[model samples]
Target chain A: MLEIKNLSARIGDKEILRGVTLSVPDGEIHAIMGPNGAGKSTLSYVLSGRDGYEVTGGEAIYNGQDILALTPEARAAAGIFLAFQYPVELPGVGNANFMRTALNAVKRARGEAELDAVAFLKLARAALKKLSMQDDMLKRNVNVGFSGGEKKRNEVLQMALLQPGLAILDETDSGLDIDALKIVAEGVNALRSETFSALVITHYQRLLDYIVPDKVHVLAAGKIVRSGGPELALELEARGYAGLEAA
Target chain B: MTALPTQRLESWRYTDLRALNAMSFAEAPAASLPDGLPDIGVPRLVFVNGRFDEAASSALPFARNFAAVDEVSDLPLARINAEHAHDGVTLEIPDGVDAGVVLLVSYANGGALHPRHRVSLGAGAALTLLEVVKGDGVYWHNPVTDIVLAQGASLAHYRLQDESQEAFHLATIRATVAADAAYESFTAVMGAKLSRAEFHVELTGAKAHTHLNAAQLLGGSQHGDFTSVVRHKAPDCSSRQTVKSVLCDSARGVFQGRIEVERVAQKTDGYQMSQALLLSPTAEMDIKPELQIYADDVKCSHGATIGALDEEQVFYLRSRGIPEDTARSMLIRAFLTEALEPVTHEGAHALFEAAIETWWARK
Candidate 1:
């Protein structure tokens, strides 16, 4: 389970997340739908401990530990994964090597046996096959020359391989087409289990249609204004987030 | 002893040699052979201090004793080398002969050492020469190498400057390439407290080519400089230079690249790029790229980028569970990929890679 209590953060002087509280229990996926400038991305960055973000107050507890006190890599080892809205490009870093390094790091932190080159390649090839991605995808640099959809798919590929307990998807459906969207959604669906939970942050409701969430929350002015079932997303899509902030 | 050039000179602006001037050095004593020398299963010539060690070397037909000759040059370092140079390698390849790979190993232990090496390749000849310089304790290593490539000849020169952390290494190389010949070289600067490798290459015939690529990995208070002057003296000649520097702690890196195209050297294709990555707040890098084009129709360009590692890239790697140090290393190795791409010799490439890894481990 993940518990975020009154999370307030700021960038420099401007406050972004102001007294935000939310919760996602085990075996559940919650979607946070919000309008522009609603502090959705800031929430994800704060949870992941990115630099330049000052967390004034509040704590995020994941499975019993205050994750807000951990480093980004530490949070990742604690089973928290944030699928970036814009996957960073790493020139000259081969995808296979990157994934293997990341996987081994996480494994080492968890006191698990690290995978060798051959074992890691075998595992990565299996994940690629499941995602319907070509073998050449592993041979290229990490998102160096990838297309918009390919970058998103690469994020999902990472998510599948890492198998985090609480995966945060931050606007991952923005630049993806329908075909790529289904592939990404399937990658998430394949990892659904009793020990898995996800916080899907998106601005659109179309993605919610494929990967239906257990709960929908409207975040505006850095706070959760309304909360409801999956149908609330469809209603918001019809009515738009016009008066949700006032609610 | 010749006076060392000061910072007032244009080429020596970023590098200061006053520390070297303060120390008085004696002649190198005859030292025993150093252990753990790299062996790649090839003919090798080993030099201790400044003299050749024939017992530890393989006898090749083309290898001969070093004989110093009077050569005039305006470069102050080359002049200093010409004054005190003694034993070195002299390799001469005959026409159409593939001389394969040869190793030149120089080990110094506290002294002022100058070794002058000369290499000449006949027409259609090919040779791959790998030079490794290393030492222990405080010393001065000033070596000058002269290379001449005839028509259709090619020479792949790979150098690894792994001097001791308290040593001063100043090397000068001059090469002249004839028509249809190529002079390709790569230098890995991973040691020395203060070091500089200056190269002067001239393409004197049509379609002559040269690639001068290097990578400098410096830490602590070390200083490394890579300066090159490529003169295109004939039409249809080309030159390429890519130098990469990674500085950490209070280390400093410098790259001075100059490309000169003569009036008759039309269709000259010259390109130069210098990039540096400073890993600490105190580390510094200085780059000077000069182009003198007298030809009306030629393609020449130069670019430089010096900056710290990207924070966003760092965050991305960290979020994926990679530790901060490993993440930085991966990014740095990525930055050096382009500069190391030209090292096609398998054994040499492996050796350079191992040296880079050792440098990182030491940090």
Candidate 2:
């Protein structure tokens, strides 16, 4: 569903992603793991079309079209969702308003019927119930005073509400504890389907144990050095990136 | 001889004095009212050039008095008003009565209109006052309002200033509060070439509470200023001041707030915060906060923040499929709402929020 070839990105004077090429087929979930400077987050941002990142030499194709040429909102409407490493806290913007705007926008772009307040509340309450969160969360400001797990769950709630075709979760598992990790994994797991695909970005194999992936790729200094089955995550956790670098 | 405030004074640092020296500032004519005003089904007091029109205004069912403007202020514009004020409107609320919405409108053109007014709340009385200043041409609108709240009385004052782009506006409000009285004021500054709204509040009785919430939205070369002074003379009184401004183009915004606690005002809790959002590189904001405390046991603090639209938040919103303009509007509204949240009266809150929405739409 998504294709990237010869992706090179740079921010200012430093080059982050250099000649990285990767792809994920429809109905398959993939994982990207690497060291600190492995350009894991850069790959996600490059795919999501964030500003200030100069794509020096790369073309990202999503659903057979060049996604890099599209604006960030266009990419999102085209079914690309990026769960940021750190969610922003909008002080006075209510969660319900943000979710409604986002959901209606995506739905409108996809030629689907938009939901009004009442209809939107019903749908949102269902999703909140699935996440075991209260209805009061919708009244509060977006991510304002929310715990780390709650913020991550809010991101997932957004993803579930928007129902994007492709999701890039960057470092979503970094700060989650066991219970949070289980809920987060369950949230992603619940969305698994033939039409949906996710690019799970993480540093450890802990998340892989819950939300098993079809394929795992080792990203080093911006390039995909190795591609293997789920066992690659366990192997990397055991021997570290040094084992892969030596190979 | 008491000296009128001028550019030489520290309080009028950024505003120019030469401009005021040039204007004739003659008493303006009684121009007609505007075509549209909010339909809140309340008593309306309409004024033209500071003169009350008995034929146009509704019959006064309650109590009212019109006297010569006499009280003088150290501010230059207040002095000007004292020297030449046209008429005044005083609405005194009786005990335990909840006066709905009182709409006060002032219209002017090519002149200085000084309207002095007073609002005295009886014990346990409540009121919501909507004061609107709007007009055209090159006029100077100077208004003074005195508010006194009796024991356990409460008042919600909403001030909406939408003057001509070529006009000048200067207004001052001095208020006193009794024991357990609640005073909440919200001002939305949207128009005027040069405008200043000064609020001086004194908590005279113990356990009184006061909230001064204001929002200023200016674009182009417009200038808006909100200067306030809050004094606590009684014990256990609390005061909160939140002022937010959004300046675009070369618009300039100024916020000066001061809080003073006397020795008898122990356990006084005062908090003041001023924030500005500059949408353009040339937009300027000057914020000054002061706290004077003779009570060692009092708790008082003030803070100020000035910044441009956060790029990260913008990007995050856009990444979620919201357009840039919508994202900007959301952030600006959020910024303003943070300061406007304290407005309790539904009518005044909606009016203030509507003014903000209109400013956002125009900008």
Candidate 3:
């Protein structure tokens, strides 16, 4: 569903994602495991269309369209969702209102009818239930004052509501405890379908235990050095990235 | 004499309307509110051109308020004159009267230059005062309000200032809170060619408290300033001030807040914060928040910040299918949301938010 062909990106004068190429087909979960400053987040951002990241070379296509040509919102409407490494805390914007706006924006792009307040609440409640989050979260500001686990779950809650075709989760498990990780992974796992795909960018194999990926890729420096089955994640966990980088 | 520009006057330099002196305003004829306002509230005093109009003023059942002095003939108008004193309204909450009051001040084009209002909250009295200032045409409006809080009195004041693009609006509010009194003021400014508001609060008695919050949203070449001073003069007094502004296009905004704690005001606590968001490259903001503490036992702190819209937040929203413009507008609205939170009246808060949305829409 998503394809990155020799995608290269840079931040100011420094090149990060140097001609990195990868593809994740529908109905499968892919993992990109890399150490810090290894351009793992850079790949996610480049695919999601973040500012200050210049794509010096190559192309990224989603659903047969050049993703680079579309604005971040357009990409999202085209079914691209990026769960930020650190979710923003919008102090006054209610979570429900935010989800409704985003859902409607995507629907509008797809020529679908917008959901009214009643319909939105009904759908949102079901999604929140899947994430095991309380209804109070809807009334509260978007992620404001939420614990790290809560913010991560909020991101998944948004993903569940948006129902995007492809989701790029960048370090969503970083601050999550084991139990919280299970719930988050369960939320993502439940969304897995014949038409849904995801790029799970993480450093630990613990998250892989929850939402097992169909394939694992080792991203070192600016390129993917190796690709293997979910068992590769175990191998990398047993033998740290330091050993693999020198291999 | 030209007003002292001590970061006080020409602070409007970037978007100065002082050149507006060349334009003349025609006086509005005797007029009253046309319709659709509830009359069940407490007493109200309506004035035009710093003069009271008894015939048009409303005196409801629960309404038992009006200056015992009838006219504030001896009130200070040192810097105000007939040349600038166009029209005004005043309301006084009598002793022991604990009710709510609403004052609607509407001005038309060619109206007077200055409209003044004076309000006094009697001891043991509590009141929620809603003041709405609106204008129709391109004119100059200078408004000044003076408030006095007696011992044990409390006031919840909401000031809505929305004028026209062609109008130059300037206003000042000076309030004094006596011992044990409390003052809570929220001012929202969303319109006008050149608008500036000065808020000065004096905590004069032990245990007195003052809270000031302001939100200003300006678009086009509109200009606005929210300058405030909170002085704690008595021991154990407390004060807090927060101001937020959003500017778009070539618009400009300024926030200068100062909190002072006197030496005698031991155990005093003062805090102030000013934040501004520039939505456009040409948009500019000046924020200066200061704290002067003379009491070694007092706690005082002040902070100011001016920044452009958060590009990261914008991208995050856009990546979710919200257009860039919509994302930026949402962030701007969020930036000012904190300052508007203290407004407990849902309807009033909605009206102010609507004003912000309209400003963004017009942009």
* Candidate 2 chain B, poorest ten consecutive residues by summed lDDT: B1-10
Candidate 1 lDDT by residue in tens digits, B303-336: 9999999999999999999999889889988999
In order, the Cα lDDT scores of the candidates are 0.93, 0.87, 0.79
Output the better candidate (1/3) by lDDT.
1
Of 1 and 2, the candidate ahead on TM-score is: 1
Per residue, candidate 2 scores C-alpha lDDT tens digits across A89-190 of 998899999999988877787788999999999999999999888899899999999999989988988988888889999999988888888888888999
The order of the candidates by DockQ, greatest first, is 1, 2, 3
Say which candidate scores most in DockQ. Answer: 1
* Best model number under TM-score: 1
Q: Native contacts retained per candidate?
A: 0.84, 0.76, 0.71
User: For model 3, what share of native contacts is present?
Assistant: 0.71
Task: Show the colliding residue pairs in model 3.
Answer: A73-B318, B26-B110, B43-B63, B48-B87, B49-B86, B49-B87, B50-B87, B50-B88
Chain A TM-score vs. truth, each candidate: 0.99, 0.98, 0.98
On DockQ, who's better, 1 or 3? 1
Task: Please report, as a residue range, the 10-residue window in candidate 3 chain A with the lowest summed lDDT.
Answer: A238-247
Could you report the DockQ of all the candidates, in the order they appear? 0.87, 0.76, 0.70
Score candidate 1 by lDDT: 0.93
